[model samples]
Target: MNRFRQFMSGRYGFDQFSQGLVILSLVISLIGTLTRSNILITVSYIPFIYAIYRILSKDINKRMKENYQYTMFINTVKGKFLKGKRNVTGTKTHKYYTCPKCKTTIRVPRGKGKICITCPKCRTEFIKRT
Candidate 1:
């Protein structure tokens, strides 16, 4: 146990990307098993193998960079989805709209019908009903 721990001491053992990879691999493996699909079984090993390689990798800097990139991409997509959901189910106190000129998001108080909106970033004027 001490030897194993020592071996893993400086390793890039886990990160969010690695965890995601593990989950994806497991899901693919399980689906392949359930459906008895040889192709999925083969596909599942790709992530599993890469994950194992990442865990055991000794190049700390490269691993950290890759992990950072993966997390940033995930966060970008997740943020957009969450932002869309928030826009769809806007709070009763405020309404959301996109600025037509600069495409910036504009939030205004609700129940103010037929209001003129000015883009704070681009200084473009538009009319909307809130």
Candidate 2:
């Protein structure tokens, strides 16, 4: 155990993306096993190869950068999804519109009838029905 730990000390360790790859590969392998499909099992080897390559890689800096970029991309997608969900669910009590001049998203309380809205960034005023 000590020897194994010492050997891996300088190698790139696991990250979220690596874990995800491992899990996805496992799921695919399981599906292939349960269904007795050779092609799916072959396809599942792709992520495992990448994950193993990352684990054995000695270039720690590059691996960390790759993980960081992946995490940031996932976070950006999650943020967009959450924002859209909120917009859809808040229609009962709130209204969302884009400023025509600057295309900025603006949220206003609902049931105020026709209201005048002024853009704080572009200073463009427009009338909107909420």
Candidate 3:
């Protein structure tokens, strides 16, 4: 009993933001289920299950051993949660926009207008309004 409490209190190095996201998703799912809304239930369950899976995931080693591809996917998801945003590659000096393709928030120059923006992750190109 005491050990369990201590373990819960001790920092397991799990991302708090992701934990919160999972909780939020579960709550929404519960609400959807109670309300009998199939659409909400289905959509909410995706994040809910994902959040639970991420929270229960022990570490990179276990994740890698279980499945490298899935480990990478979870790591990417964890990165987004920990960083509070997705990865973005662009000039540091310029203002940036989020890449529509990969959802990576990019940085671009302040006054750059009609500039072509490319996402490093998905390699999608689009114009940024700056």
Best by TM-score: 1
Sort by lDDT, best first.
2, 1, 3
Model 1, 1-130: lDDT tens per residue?
A: 9999999998988888789899999999999999999999999999988998999998989999999999999999999999988888887788998998789999999998999999899999999998
TM-score, cand. 2 vs. native: 0.86
Off by over 4 Å in 1: 91-93
Candidate 3 wrongly placed segments (more than 4 Å): 1-93
Give the least accurate 10-residue stretch of model 2, judged by summed lDDT: 13-22
Candidate 3 residue 46 Cα shift, in angstroms, is: 33
Compose the digit string of candidate 2's lDDT tens values, residues 1-130. 9998998999998888898789989999999999999999999999999998999899999999999998999899999999999999999999998999899888999999999998888989999999
Query: How do the candidates rank by TM-score, highest first?
Result: 1, 2, 3
TM-score of each: 0.87, 0.86, 0.30
lDDT of each: 0.92, 0.93, 0.65
Q: Please estimate how well model 2 matches the true structure, expressed as its whole-model Cα lDDT.
A: 0.93
Clashing residue pairs, backbone N/CA/C < 3 A, model 3 = 94-108, 94-109, 95-108, 95-109, 96-107, 96-108
lDDT of 3 by residue, 7-33 (tens): 656233345445556777788788888
Model 1, global lDDT: 0.92
